[model samples]
Target: MLLPRPLLVLDLDETPWHGELGEATQVTFALRPHLGFFLQAVAQAYDLAVWTAAGNDWLQAGLQAIKHETGVDLAAQAVFLWDRGRCTWRRDEAGALHFRKPARKFRARWLRARYPRERILAVDDLAANYACGYGHLVRVTPWTGAPDDTERLDLARYLLQIAPVPDLRALEKRGWRARL
Candidate 1:
C-alpha cells in the first residue's frame, strides 16, 4: 500500500533564494541550479510547501518566475505557501523584524489535530526558524546562488535517503546536512 507522502515545508529567501529582503542592501534573486529536478523528485515522495518570511508580493512574483523559468509549475508542486503575513513576528536585538523563529507558524495544535507529527518536516537554513520544530528540522546550508552551489541537489538526495524512514524522530538530534 502506498502511504501518504510526508509534509515538507521549505523556506524561500536565503534558503532557496540568495538574499533576505530586510538584511541585504541589494537583493539579488536567482533559481538555484537543479531546482526543478529537485522539486520534482521531492514531489514524487513528499508533500511540499513554501514558507517564507518575505512579503506576499515578493513571494508571489518569485514563485511565478520560478515556475516560468524552471517549468516546474510550483503552484502544482507545492501544497501551500506561507508568507510573512501568516507569521507571528517579533523584533531582534537591533529592533529589526524577525519572523524566522515562527514556531507557531507550523500550527502544531491545529495540524496535529489532523496529521502525524512524525510525517511533517521543515527544511530551512536558519535553525531559528525551527524554534519549536527541533524534532522536525532538516537544516540546510544557506543558498548563496553561487555557480558552484549544489545545496538543492544535495538536499534532494538526503530527502530521498530519509523518505523511507519509519520514525523520523528516532534519527539523530542534530540537523540533517548534505555530506560534503
Candidate 2:
C-alpha cells in the first residue's frame, strides 16, 4: 500500500498575500481568485495547514471567499487555519516582535506522533518562524501584491516535484524554486 503524503504547513500574510493586515484593502491581496485554485491543486496531493500570524477574524472572510470560488473548502481537506494564538512569540535581536515558530504548537498535538520531522514541510516568507523546523522549511519571497510576482506558480511546481519524496528534510534548499 502507498503511504500517505506529507504534511504541508503554509504561512499566510506576506507569503500568500501582500500588505499588512491592518493596512490591507481587498485589492492589496495577491492571488485572490487564483488562491483557491492553487490550494485545491496542492490539497490533492498533500495534507495542508495554514499557519499564520494574522488574527482569526481578519482571515475568515478571505478564506470563505476562496472556498466559494474554488469549491475547495479548506476545512473539508482537514486544513487547519492556525492563527497568532497558536504561534510562539519571541523578541528578535533587533528587539522586534517575532511570531513565527510552530514547533511548540506541533509538540502539543497528535501531529508530533503521527508525522515524522522528515515528512513535514513549512513554507514561510520569514525563516525565523520555521527556524525550529530545521530541514523542513521553505523560504519564499514576501509577496507585495506585485503583478510580476510569480512565486505562487513556482511554489506549486516545486511542491509537485517533492511531494513523493520519502524524506522532505533531506531535500536541499536549492532543490525548490520560490519565484520564476
Candidate 3:
C-alpha cells in the first residue's frame, strides 16, 4: 500500500514573497525567484498548506497575487490556509509582540488523522515563528526582492529529497542549505 503524502506547511512573508507598502491603500508584492517552479515541484510529493502570521486579508491578497503571477492556485490547492487568528501570540525578550505556529496544533483530531507529526514539515525564514516546533521547521533565508535568491530552488530539492523519510522531525534540518 502506498503511504499518504506528507504535509508541507508554508510561511508567506519573507519565505515566498516580499510585500512593500506602496501607498496608503496599496501593497506591492515581489515573489521569490523560482517560487513557481518550487511550488509545482514540491506539490508532486507533498500536500501543501499555508500558515502565516499575517491577517486574513493580507494572506488572501498574497495568495491571489501568487496565483496571478505563477498560475498556481495556492488557496485551492492548500489543505488549509491559516491566518494570524490561528497563531499563538507571545512577547519576545524585548516585549515585542510576535506570533508563533505551535506544532501541537497538528495533534488536533482532524489534522492527526491526515498527518502525524513525523509526516509534517514547515518552511519559514524566521526560526522564532516556529520556536515551539523546531523539529518541524525547514529554515530558509529571508527573501526581500533579491533577484539572485535561490532559496526556493534549493529548498524544493531538499524537501523532495527528504520527503520519503519516515520521521522528518528527527532529521537535523538546520544545515539544509549545505546539504544541497
What lDDT does each candidate get?
0.73, 0.71, 0.92
Compared with the true structure, the alpha-carbon lDDT of candidate 3 equals: 0.92
Per-residue CA lDDT of candidate 3, range 1-180, in tens? 566679999999998999888879698889999989999999999999999999998999899999999999999999999999889997879999988898888899999998988899999989988888899999888888989988787899999999998889999998887887
- Candidate 3 has a TM-score of 0.96
Considering only N, C-alpha and C atoms within 3 Å, which residue pairs clash in candidate 1?
none
lDDT of 2: 0.71
Residue 162 miss distance in model 3 (angstroms)? 0.5
- Give lDDT: candidate 1, residue 165: 73
Number of the top-ranking candidate, with TM-score as the measure: 3
Task: Give the per-residue lDDT digits (tens) of candidate 2, residues 46-109.
Answer: 8988888877865665566556656766655654678888887888799998886666566656
Q: Once all C-alphas are superposed, what RMSD does model 1 give against the true structure?
A: 3.6
Can you write out model 1's per-residue Cα lDDT over 53-111, one digit (the tens) per residue? 88787887778767887787776767678888777667889998766545555556766
List of clashing residue pairs for candidate 2 = 100-129
Q: Could you arrange the candidates by TM-score from highest to lowest? A: 3, 1, 2
